[model samples]
Target: MRDALRRLSQGEAHPFDVSTGWDVVWEHARYPQKAVLGLAAGRLAERPLGPYDFKAGECRRILTRLGFAPVPKRSGGQESDDADDAAEADLRQRTGLGPTEKASLIRARRGQGIFRQNLERVEKRCRITGLRDRIHLRASHIKPWRSCSDHEKLDGNNGLLLSPHADHLLDRGFISFEDSGALLIADALDTRVLDQWRISQPRNASAFRAAQCKYLSYHREHIFLGRED
Candidate 1:
């Protein structure tokens, strides 16, 4: 493997057909894996690094593009920190918030400040686990705060108190709730995770008020990935 990459990078001849793109008609409407490969098929998916055939070319290409070809100075240099810097800069322009105000507001978005206090008053425990401890729970927005208006961002009715694991599932669209409060599991989610996490996928533990249901409706319609059963 090492020799092949070295030879390839040095423009030396190699005996590896690692640059063939196979047309993989899989992964579907949910994940969109069509037009996947091929240097020049009936249709080519020009994805930057796929020229090296599907067998091994893609892997080699990714290793180099990710800047993992190996550096003399930094043995394992990390990826850039620019993502957060860019996101924060964008946030400042959108919200017109100075550094101090934006800092606390960002904290509130991650479950702190008045938003969390209001959520605590309405939701006493993690919905999925029934865990009453606040320390182990996170204040999760039903309609994500990132896409919300300021009014919705802070609305207690727009949030839920969820355990960290449950928050992850919901945030990533692995699960959601119907307006009637029934659990809606995503087709892509591994059912084994429910057992491992000890999640029961409860139904109607407590009724959501009309206002809360309003936001949950958006969750089911848009955020819920798709049905499993």
Candidate 2:
């Protein structure tokens, strides 16, 4: 997969989001190592563990083939759920390539060109608040790059241009949008952060289209943190 990503960087591939590159591989390995990698990948525990089992020795071999470091016996010890969580958290912090990001990576590997093409069409401004600082902006996923297909990534209808602060919250399921393009804050956010960003103000008179609203719904459902009053 890394080889494919390198090839992609050489201009032979589509424009893929950096975060999405890991998702594709995780989905591939979800089956055999569901318990081990599943916890590592941060899937809900409600999901049943797959019947498949491999001892630490065997898991080490599989991890080698997949280009990952072998799981240490004490280091999660192959499907030990408690330790598995620890290892998973460590991997996530180091790589920022959680399950969601893994899915994004896979999509990126498949369609590098198309993703870039679409991002170009989306103007470099926050579609929500119309903040236009380039250094502070990000090309956000509407359907999310990981779950998105090549076509979806390229679809102008499936994205929002956002500033980095807003993008960080949006990416982490912290913020959402109203049907009318108003910024909605998560309850978890300190009131100070909200005031700092001026999230209380409604969007200016930019006349947002329904397409933006459509994507906002996904953000609200999947990414938005905290409950509404």
Highest-lDDT candidate:
1
Per-candidate TM-scores read 0.59, 0.45
- Give candidate 2's root-mean-square deviation (CA, Å): 16.8
- Best candidate, TM-score: 1
Candidate 1: 10-residue stretch with minimal lDDT: 71-80
What would the TM-score be for candidate 1 when compared with the true structure? 0.59
Residues 1-229, candidate 1: write the lDDT tens digits.
3333333445543333221111122222110111122222212334333322432223323443544321111111121124334544667776566776666556657778777988888889987888898898999989866556666767788899998998987876677887666777765578899989987765556777788998887666445555423
Residue 229 lDDT, candidate 1, scale 0-100: 38
